[model samples]
Target: MQFFVWAAWLITIANYWFGTKQWDGADFGVIFSTMGISSLFMPTITGIIADKWINAEKLYAILHILYAATMFYLPQVDNPHTFFWVILVAMCFYMPTIALSNSISYTTLKNGNFDVVKNFPPIRVWGTVGFIAAMWITNLTGSKASANQFYIAGVSALFLGIYSFTLPACKPQNLISEKKTFAQKLGLESFKLFADYKMALFFIFSMFLGAALQLTNAYGDVFLDEFKLFPVFAESFVIKYSTIILSISQISETLFILAIPFFLKRFGIKWVIAIAMFAWVLRFGLFAFGDPSANLWMIITSCIVYGMAFDFFNISGSLFVETSTTPKIRSSAQGLFMMMTNGFGAVFGSLISGWMISKYFTTYYTNIGSLSKYVNSEADNAHLLNFLKNKGITVLQNGDLSRALDVKDWHNIWLAFTIYVLVIAIVFVVIFKHKHTRAEVEAINHL
Candidate 1:
């Protein structure tokens, strides 16, 4: 159930935004910003409901069903305006499922006598495997940019929603008896983590790093396909199989998630997270220099590095929260983590990157005013016509001769982002101070 839900969404949505909808950066920014706006409080609000009023599995299942319905209708959206609201509605129902899924999983695993930290990584790695599978399925079917990808996601969500009911029944705790304060009753007790210097710094860095995460997700596919601008590479395998190639990152994730339990034990959470931060530098730097033909290996290597860059922080950071917080406020702590990373970070990155791409990165090619602009020579008109034809664009008839293409300077764009992550890493290493003890991680597993 978890596998299918994640697999469907991450692999196709960006391509749908950049390729099919033909959204500009500003428009795309609005789409991602919705998560921040709604997700800011949705997870916590839902957590309170699930803990007090309803079953976790039931809440999760209903969210998936609503998510499926929203996605099913998403194809009918004709403009970014409709698309934005529809996606927001989907995200509102979808984001809390992340926390709720974890809640259900922990409850199920404990009931089954499986140690969470020791056993959960291996289980969660399958979600990455599922993600890789969906990417390949979409790319092989040539549906990454098609409405069919959303259909695929919707059908999967519908199935997951139904399948969830068969899983363990995670009934409400009705913990209202033990709670004392108004804020704690509302699951806001976890906000006290912000008052601590170390945690405050960690979350602040998480938001910054989350922005870098968003940048890569937002542009990786679009930038790879932008290689089509070069005639020699237009029909090359990279452009043809970009999403498949990008799936290497998710494939690498399965391997890395298995390594996290060891990494947290050996390096402790501090250095393990720092390794991820530096890996982001390599991820973006390699992409800046990579191309389809001679430098394809660079692109592949960048994808491989993405596993470490993404899973390291996400999995390891979650473990950090798991070990640090009491069970009473665990859901709230996790929700806060998601809010910082997915909500604030996503919004900040999307809105800012959209503006950056529109202002500095987007290129407007010379618009041909009249067919006669190239009439001086048959060779020139043939060249222009052939190029547009290759792009599958039609030549305007008669006086409607103006045509232009917008290309992005992907090289500079990625390099600037590489520098951005590199600086965040340096600042993280310098400013955030936490001394690790094995007891911190070991104590919880033994309990």
Candidate 2:
């Protein structure tokens, strides 16, 4: 339900903002930071509240209900600024539920006397399935670039929240009762790990790669959809089925996750992570050159590579943390990794990339008059007109353009991402060092 609710709007919303509402690219970029900002504190705060004062299941249900309500209100927002705040409120209610869901699962599983390590992963796999299903439904139903995506998600969230009541209760406990101080409750002691050179460096790179993660999610769907601007590709299957094509990444993610145990054992965590970084290099590089026509294979290959690009870094990095950190600070260390990657890293990626893309990659056409004046010859003008057509631009009855048409240079935007991840991969290979034993690899399974 969680995955379905998010997947319904997350990928395709780019098209809604850019294609439907005609909002600025920089503004669209800021919307993603809402997740990062909420990720920074809401999970911890909600975790504390759930641990000390409330039943985890009930809290999870209530948050989803609130998320659903907020999502329902989102389609009424006519402007990007108001849309940002409304989505921010939705994110605040939604982000923490990810952690809360896990907590509830573990508690329910334990109460059922099931082995969490053995059972939890299979259950989690269904979340990806849910995500893929939502994407397919959104695209097939013609809701990808419309407010109907939000309605689909809102309905799912509402159903999930109501259904959660039927699940086994996971009551609050005395788990953190001994940790009296607010700092202790929040696990601020994990901040001391930043003093260690290796741990600190690992986190710094995590943030860098985290930025890379957001780039694809933010732009990928819209990139394919933007091909519609070119008349040659406007009716192409790639534009029509872009979300389903993107869903291949999630499908690949599940399959690649199964291969991680082998990769970790064979290559060690550091090299596995390095491979993931390089995989990202390939992912972006392929996208940089891919098109909806003959270059379509590049797009498909890139989707396949995303599994290794994402799972190898995220899952392997978690194992590395589990092995390296002392048990006392281990849980907090995991939180710190997530914070650096999904929190600070997300904010860094979203805001900076937004500004950068708006400044460099996006082209604005004020009107037909400006377009003609900017072109060097009739031939070039004809070519530009053939490319842009009459899809997104607006004309005024007074003979002035009502809105500026913004077209993004997708090739260079992807090439820039490729270069960024490639540089990080090279720096990581040179600077970070770790030796893994067979026991260390095996220990991950036991944990």
Candidate 3:
């Protein structure tokens, strides 16, 4: 249910921006930033409440219920300003539960005397499966661009919110004995982890990669649906069902997450993360060259690679923090990890990428009906290109300007993303160092 809450909207948000709202690219940044803004404090604040005042499962339930209610109202919002605040409220309810869910799972596992390191991965894999299932449901049902997608998400969330209360209780540790300040009780002391050279470097890299994560979510659907502008490709499967096509990525995520234990055990964290970083480059590069018609294979392959690209870093990085940090500060360390990646990193990526798209990828066409007037003269074509390029615009040469306006700028936009991945990969290669072993896993479990 938690996974689906995110999947239902994440991929299709771009479609909503470009298709339903007909909003500018810069506005999409505001949409994506809600996630980051919510992430900035929601997880930590909720963590404190769960630790001190509320039961984890109960808090989780309340969050979901609130989230569902907000989602139900989202389709009614027409103005972007109203939409932003509504989405922000929804995110506030939604984001904290991610960490809360992890906490609930870990507590449940420990109380049951199950080995978390051995048992948790298998259960967690189901969350990814749930995510994929949600994506498929939304895509197959053709709710990708409809307000009904929120209805689907809201109904499911309401069920999960209620169901969470039925789960096993996760009580507070009460470790301090005497009451400490709220910050101290919540494990804010974990901030000291930043003082460690290796830990700091790992976190910095996580931030960089987090930046890459939002790119596809912000643009993938818009890119696929943009093909509808071309008459020949308008009827293509991808154009008609872009969300379902993109669901392939979530499906791939499930498979790769199941493989994480083997890969982490065999290659260690460094190599696994390197593979993820490089895979991101391929993911974007493929999108740069792929089309619904001739390059459908590239598009599909890119989706397949998304599994490895995302799980390799996110799951592995979380485990890395779990294993490396002290027990007293473990939860706080996880929150900090999230803060860096999902908060600062995501905010920067979404806002900047949105600006880039609005500035460089949006195209304008003049004298559209008189093709010969513009195309036959080389000087005229160059003049047009220069004019568009100077305005950070894309010029579609496919003889149909109106339909191609939204996507023509994608070529240049994706190139810039490709460059970002390359630099990030290089930095990861230089800075991050970690080795996973059975012995180390055993040690963490003991702790």
Write the residue-wise lDDT of candidate 1 on 1-447 in tens digits. Answer: 566665565645766776555566567777777777777878878888898888999999999999999989989998888898998998898888887888898999999999986787677767767777777777778886788878888999999999988889999988567536767666678889999888888888888888887787667777787676555676798888788899898888877866777777777787888999999999989998999999999999999999999989997788778777778788778778888899899889888888887789876554455334334566556665666565445655543424345567788888888888889889888887776656566742442
lDDT (tens digit, per residue) of candidate 2 on 306-350: 999999999988888887788989999999999989998998999
Q: Which ten-residue region of model 1 has the weakest summed lDDT? A: 366-375
As a whole number from 0 to 100, the lDDT of residue 109 in candidate 1 is: 95
Estimated TM-score for each candidate: 0.89, 0.94, 0.85
C-alpha local distance difference test of each model: 0.79, 0.89, 0.81
Top model number, TM-score: 2
True lDDT of residue 247, candidate 2: 96
What's model 2's lDDT at 149?
Answer: 99
Candidate 2 residue spans exceeding 4 A from truth: 369-392, 395-400, 437-439, 445-447
What lDDT tens digits, residue by residue, belong to model 3 across residues 1-447?
A: 789887887788777766766666777887888899999878877877887788999999999999999999999988888888999999999998988898899999999999997898788778877887887888888888778789988999999999998999997765557767767765677779989988999888888889898898888887888765544565788987888888889889878876877777667777888889999999999999899988999999999999999989987788788778878788789888888889888988889998888877776444344434334566656655553343344545754443333434677677789889989898888766666666557643442
Instruction: Give stretches of model 3 more than 4 Å off.
Output: 171-175, 365-408, 431-447
Select the stronger candidate by TM-score from 1 and 3: 1
**Prediction 2 TM-score vs. true:** 0.94
Candidates ranked, most accurate by lDDT first: 2, 3, 1
Return whichever of 2 and 3 wins on TM-score.
2
